[model samples]
Target: MSLFWSIYVGVLVTSNLGLAIFLYIYGTRVKIPIEGDGTTGHSWDNGHLRESVRRLPRWWAMMSLTSIVVAIGYLILFPGFGNYKGLLGWTSEQQVSEARVANAQKLDQMFARYRQYPVNQLAGDSTARQYGNRLFQDNCAACHGTRAEGGHGFPALTVNGDDGDFVVSTALAGRTGVMPPWGAVLGEQGVTDVANYVLSLSGAPHDAARAQAGEPRFKETCAACHGAEGKGTKALGAPDLTDHSWIYGGDLASVEQSIRDGRTGHMPAWKDRLGEDQLRLIAAWLRYNALTEREASIAAPVADARR
Candidate 1:
């Protein structure tokens, strides 16, 4: 606090303490004249009651003294006395720093062990998976879902995190999936036709006539990039439209909008944001989660025998 404010607070506290102490002592000892009826000259409740004055109880006086002593001691020993640090020399910042050091020390050993394993092997470990889950929940949960299902603009992390294709790209910094809005090039009608064609690539319900009409334009323009199957070139960070799984949305209207105005979403580059240790752990976690989902496909007897 400023000097003036500190002086003001000191004055107020002094005045309050002085008044309370005086009242406590004087109120108990002061004499009050009483009627012979053994009551003060006060009546209430239709004369059925009369006020009686009593000295403060010995226990109450002791309690009050104890509280005052504690307050004074606290003011002398703590920061309450106008920015005066306590004799104990404790501070919140110091406490937080100490806690962080302790936490880091504990994690140091874990990191050492983690660094020994390859990213692929680490993904299979139960302990690493647990730690990775917690780390992901803390850092990645905001953009990705709690379960990593994803939303309108966010990529589905359930598949992305675990799969080799996505994990490799996502790690060593992150990836930006940008489909620049093609609206200006296509105009309104051309945008709609191309969107239908994109949907047809996935076997999604679309207007065949419009998609056919868009084929020439698509081959000349979009095919150079989106590919003949619309399977998107990962080399360009282009999404596989044929999966019917959209980074934005899968509906006809949303698909049309993506082609019309395009979409740009950024998943932050993690190179500088996180330490190398964290990056490796996160990559392992992603692979672990994605591998589990592929079990059904690989569970077949014929597939197992081949493996």
Candidate 2:
């Protein structure tokens, strides 16, 4: 603290403590004059009530003295007195630092057991999954929904066929996917045609004539990132065009805007914020959810056949 502020605080503290001490001492020792009726010359409600002075109660006096002593002791042993470092030389920052170190050590011990298993295998462990789910909710749930179902402008985690290693690596390093604008090159009509053709790839509704016209153009231009079959390249983070999944909406206008204006999607790297073990835990939970969804999908077909 600045010298002026420190001295100001010290003065304020000393003045307050002095006033309290003075009040305590004077209150107990000072005597007040009283009438023969033993009441002070004060009354209310047509003299039904009258004020009287009495000695300070013994218990109240003792408690007040104790509180004063404790306050002085606290000031001497702690940093309450302005810039005094205190006899113990303790600091709030030091306390927080020590707490963080202790917490990290405890986490390390817990994660040690998890290190033995690969992320895929770790997904099968209920305890690990519980931790993973909590971690995912804390870190990943904002972009990927609580259920990992994704939202507009965000890819769904559950549907991605990514394995644990891929998930972990991506989380650690991050990824950026850029779809360059083809509006100027493709012209207005060409943009509409290509959008329709892209929709056709996913079996979404589209004009047949426009789709046919845009096929050659799509193969020539878009096939580099989105495969000729429109299945996407995972390495490039290009979403699979053949699937129902759409980072933006799957509607016709949305697809046209994407082709014309382009889109950029970013997944932030977590290496600085989260350790590898924590990332692996998140990957494991995601894998578990994906597997569970796949199993349910498979069973639904079998049950439908029986019905």
Candidate 3:
């Protein structure tokens, strides 16, 4: 508080306490002349009432004295007095700092153990998995969904799955997948043909000759980033076209539009937002989920494929 406010507060507090003390003391000892009728001479209500003079009740006096002493003790021990900062010298900043230290110490112990395991190995750990799950839910769930299954414009993590290096590389730094719009360059027919070709590469249904026709154009324009086979360059974060996974959509029209115009999906860097330790834990869980699901996919080839 400024000197003026501090002094103002001090004066008010002092006056309040002083008044209470004076009243307590005076109430007990003030004397009044009493008549034989056991009443003070003061009368009211047209003489129907006469005031009775008596000692302050012992209980009330004791309570008031206790309250005064407690208030004074509080002012001395804590921060009630203006600008004094109290005898304890406590501050909210100091308390928070102390709490942060304790919290860091606890987390450091858990993180130390986590560090021993690679992101892959940590996926198997129950404690790490539990922590990783919680961490992912808090940070990644908004975009990736509660189950990490992903949504429109976001890559499906569980579907066909990408390899560890691909996933980790994207997670660590983050990546923006850009398929620049080719609509203006390729006429409507060319866009449809190229989309069929991309679909054909993954063994999805397409007019084979049309797909073959589209290849020359695809090689001329798309091969550099998407690669000769359309499996995509992981280094470039060009998605594997051979995979069934699709970011925009896997349908025929969706693929055509993608080929004609293109699309971009941006995953922001979580490192600073979530902190290193937390991001690492979430990364661990994603790594775990990816590996387990990929294995299961291979083991159970789509039933239709078996035929």
For model 3, how does the per-residue alpha-carbon lDDT over 1-307 read when each residue is reduced to its tens digit? 8998888888888999999889988888888779988897789999899998677789998998999999998888777667878889887889999999999899998798877666667667778878978987887788878777777788777642324444555666788878888878878877877888999998898988888888988888889999999878766667778877777788889898888877888878765666667666776777778777778767777765888
lDDT of 2 by residue, 117-209 (tens): 999899999999899999999999998889888899889887672389988988999999999999999999999999999999988999999
Q: Which 10-residue window of candidate 1 scores lowest in summed lDDT?
A: 160-169
RMSD of 1: 4.8
lDDT of each: 0.76, 0.91, 0.79
lDDT winner: 2
- Candidate 1 local distance difference test against the native: 0.76
Candidate 3 TM-score over all chains jointly: 0.72
How far out, in Å, is residue 221 in model 1?
A: 3.7
**Model 1, stretches more than 4 Å misplaced?**
35-38, 41-50, 109-112, 125-127, 164-174, 183-193, 209-220, 223-228, 233-235, 270-285, 293-307
Candidate 2's displacement at residue 2, Å, is 0.8
Ranking of candidates on lDDT, top first:
2, 3, 1
lDDT of 1 by residue, 55-105 (tens): 778999889888878887887777666557778877788999999999988
**Candidate 2: misplaced stretches above 4 Å?**
45-48, 296-307
Root-mean-square deviation of every model: 4.8, 2.0, 5.3
lDDT value, candidate 2, whole model = 0.91
> Which model, 1 or 3, shows the larger lDDT?
3
Candidate 3: C-alpha lDDT: 0.79
Q: Which candidate is the best by TM-score?
A: 2
TM-scores for every candidate against the unseen true structure: 0.76, 0.93, 0.72
